[model samples]
Target: MRLAMLDLDSYLLRAFLTVAEIGTVNGAAVKLNRTQAAVSMQIRKLEELVGVTLFSRSSKGLELTSHGQIMLAYAREMVALSDEVGKRLTGKMIEDRIRLGVVEDFAAGHLIDILSAFRAQNPKVEIDIIVEPNRRLAKLFEDRKLDLVVCDITCLSRKPTLIWTEYLMWTVRSDFVADTEKPLPIIMFEEECPWTLPTIAALSQRNVKWKTACVASTLVAMATAVRVGIGIAPMMLTTKPEGCRTLDRSADLPGPVRIEIGLYAQPETAEGARYLVDFISRHTAILSS
Candidate 1:
């Protein structure tokens, strides 16, 4: 019965916590890297299995019914526990190796400061910092190949907590302007970019069509394309590339596209896990404030 009740994936638990954090099936889908349909079905299945209505649709988004809210807290705790187990079981013992992965966007931003402080705090811990695509980074985390990742909070991710949200902006060359007919010539990271969904959604809302003219898997490639007028891209407001200028659409742009940067660790090792989480929490104040 226990085996039947909770599959290793804990899809129901993830779905519940994701809905609570993002406030919509679509949003949860992005974090989970699943389709909206898939997320909806998962939620439905979870609700059916548990025999409770977890959420109610709202104009703002999805609001948790009181029952949903109560369950959400429990679900989050369970998921965190699972991740802690993974963290503890994988890799060398805690003091020996601390493998950290981060998205390139943060390489130029506050990551350096954070790492520097971390090293100062834990002088004996060996840290390996890997810069990779968002998807790849998350995969490493899931595979227990990485101890922690400092990357944009992707909709597909179920492990990360909401650290902070960053404003999204469209960065284009100074001389670049969109033509009336063509969808913007987009230069994007090859399928692994985390913010790709928001970009697509914003364009869809504006009735602007777009095509990926170039696909480079790295931030540098995408930035180069934007600099040379390949296409405009939505970038984090906190960290903009050197030459790119913000584009003004004269209307409300898609949003304060919130980019959440978070940390992940195995759930079973609360002592070590809490240490890493607390480390991030302390330095994360700079971003939020």
Candidate 2:
């Protein structure tokens, strides 16, 4: 008896996963480094060989047909199997660098514990941690300079595949209550800080006069200013600086801003990317608890 040929190239599974997660042929094309037409063609070929229409297009985007959704479950399992096979053949999992960018506010909190866990799980993997404002972090991730980032964004452009929301609070010096009637002194990050949007919206709505007394590019500077009775700035409860406490301006501030923290990776690592995402997700639990 002759063995039938197998149309197996492990790359196909990864491509399929990207298309499903991103929901657009163009998005998947960017991840797979292929033209949109090429990506559509391969997906068509895969469906043809499998004898089904996997996805359907709509005004919203490419959505999985019921058949596609069912196949996605098996496709993930197949992809995992292929990775394990590759690892076995190589005698170890192939080492890769994960360039990670995060905002400084997270530095004072459980972010370190999350990184510690990730390092233990992936000891051979290298991580270059970049501490920057949310805007710069977004730019680096989009440019492929960073493989993953935990960003605080009101709305994300690259389409965060996974996200979690955290409550925002105001941090001010206890002594600053005396100047409540006057324009409040504000300690703020230079620009593009995640809290800036909500803070501005809150003050405008509350008819509060405010001016920046201290401007810094890093969270440390912002915390130091707030500690020395300089001004008020918004902070996440889990990430507040050691000496600072939340301001009791629930009435003056806009309802808690929902900071969406996310983990993003280029589409190629669709299978292995889960470990990093899960790590980040677990790390973010510190925010709520």
Candidate 1: where are CA atoms >4 Å away?
1-96, 152-157, 179-182, 252-256, 269-274
TM-scores of all models?
0.59, 0.67
Scored by lDDT, the top model is 2
- Give the alpha carbon lDDT tens digit for every residue of 147-227 in model 2: 777786553576665566776677876555635567777776666566776667767787777888888677777778878
* Per-candidate RMSD, Å: 11.6, 7.1
- Across 6-38, the per-residue lDDT of candidate 1 in tens digits comes to 443477777777776667788778767899998
